[model samples]
Target: MRERDIVGREGRFIAEGKVVLNVLLANPAFALESLLVLENRLAGLTGQIKLCPADVPVYCVARDVMDTIAGFPMHRGILAVGRRNDRRSSEELILAMPDKALAVVLCGISNHDNMGSIFRNAAAFEADAVLIDETSCDPLYRKAIRVSVGAALKVPFAREGSIEAIVTRLQSAGFEMFALTPSGMTSIHDAKPARRTALLLGTEGEGLPKSLLENLQTFKIPMSANFDSLNVATASGIALSRFSRFSGF
Candidate 1:
């Protein structure tokens, strides 16, 4: 396949899990930066956009059909195949996090905007990496990136496939998993944010699935008596703000 048009190199695609695979890269810069950020293999590479792998100039000829194929606009201009990060045991992520860190866990959230807003809030509230359940929308998706102004790129993340696995992992690592529910048992105002806590927020439409609901320590964002629930992203901002200042580390 002929390399795609010469969309000028936009630096690199720097993220974890989404790299590391021996992906048939159409653009070498995006592929290389994606893997090098892992620190596992960070040697013998200049951090510039020079085409060192001279045999394969960074080119992908799919731009003409990309929009029709992906069902969305291609903002990043380049595409590649990369494996999603392995579901890290919740404990592994928790232990790696700082003491009393405020982290947001995206559970069953599909709207790219909602996903981006969650991360933007996490960064705004000084929260640590945003944790996403295995079923959540990718924060690195193109629209998500645009919506987040690349804040999704700025924050760190640990992705998990199962709600139970993440809860068990976080619990084992000494982090509380507060499941946000409209009909939850405790209100956010009365709830205390732990120095090390993970908020498990559900999607806006269906709320938490019964399986996840049964597993989480639920919390409600107290609202005007008549208001049923806040939009998932907005509620996250409010909840995150409560914990932001005390995280003074």
Candidate 2:
């Protein structure tokens, strides 16, 4: 696809909709397919793109410029901003799932790469859902979806507010809430999740907030001496592997 189909083209041409600055940068292949959702005609694009088959929002910018407004840059190129994706509700997501299924509950994680990795790991492990707290980065944001290698586009996800409410709902639905932290005495190997589990991973720098820590079940990934912790993405990958069991034990 041409660059205009990816992000906005130039002046006089608006973005397809209210897409964030980054997601457009993430997936350059997103474009009008049917009604709402976007379709990727080109393969091997970084993931950061999404669309619905029902939304009718559209606009046109006449041309593309290698550098239009900011006359100078490290690289010159045209850009297109995609439409904003609709966020699903937690109830809708739960109802959409089968019983005793697994989903990833991303806590206050902020880094785009970590968000992307979490989605990739979710897809890799066959988790049922990927839920993000209100404060977390938008997984649909171009870089995240791109970094997630389009796993963000493939996985069923919901962006919600109030981590407490979402967690409570998950708990009520019988999800085992395991908070991934370095401080926990029980390692992931010992904690061992079941068929129905909610892996709650925290942020990049400060880790889980004290408020969330107070309520959820917490644990750490046991590492070699002197090594404090792994990058949030790496740790999630390692933790995800442990969920692998003998003949689906």
lDDT by residue (20-119, candidate 2, tens digit) is: 2233334433433322212221121223233432452322222232223323330312233344343458867866777767778887788877898888
Q: In model 2, which runs have C-alpha deviations exceeding 4 angstroms?
A: 1-86, 244-247
Q: Which candidate is the best by TM-score?
A: 2
Please give each candidate's TM-score. Answer: 0.65, 0.68
**What tens-digit string does per-residue lDDT give for candidate 1 at 50-96?**
43245433333354565454445554444432223333455556677
- State, as a TM-score between 0 and 1, how close model 2 is to the true structure: 0.68
The stretch of ten residues in a row with the least summed lDDT in candidate 2 is: 35-44
lDDT top scorer: 2
Give the per-residue Cα lDDT of candidate 1 at 210.
Answer: 82
- CA RMSD for every model? 8.9, 7.9
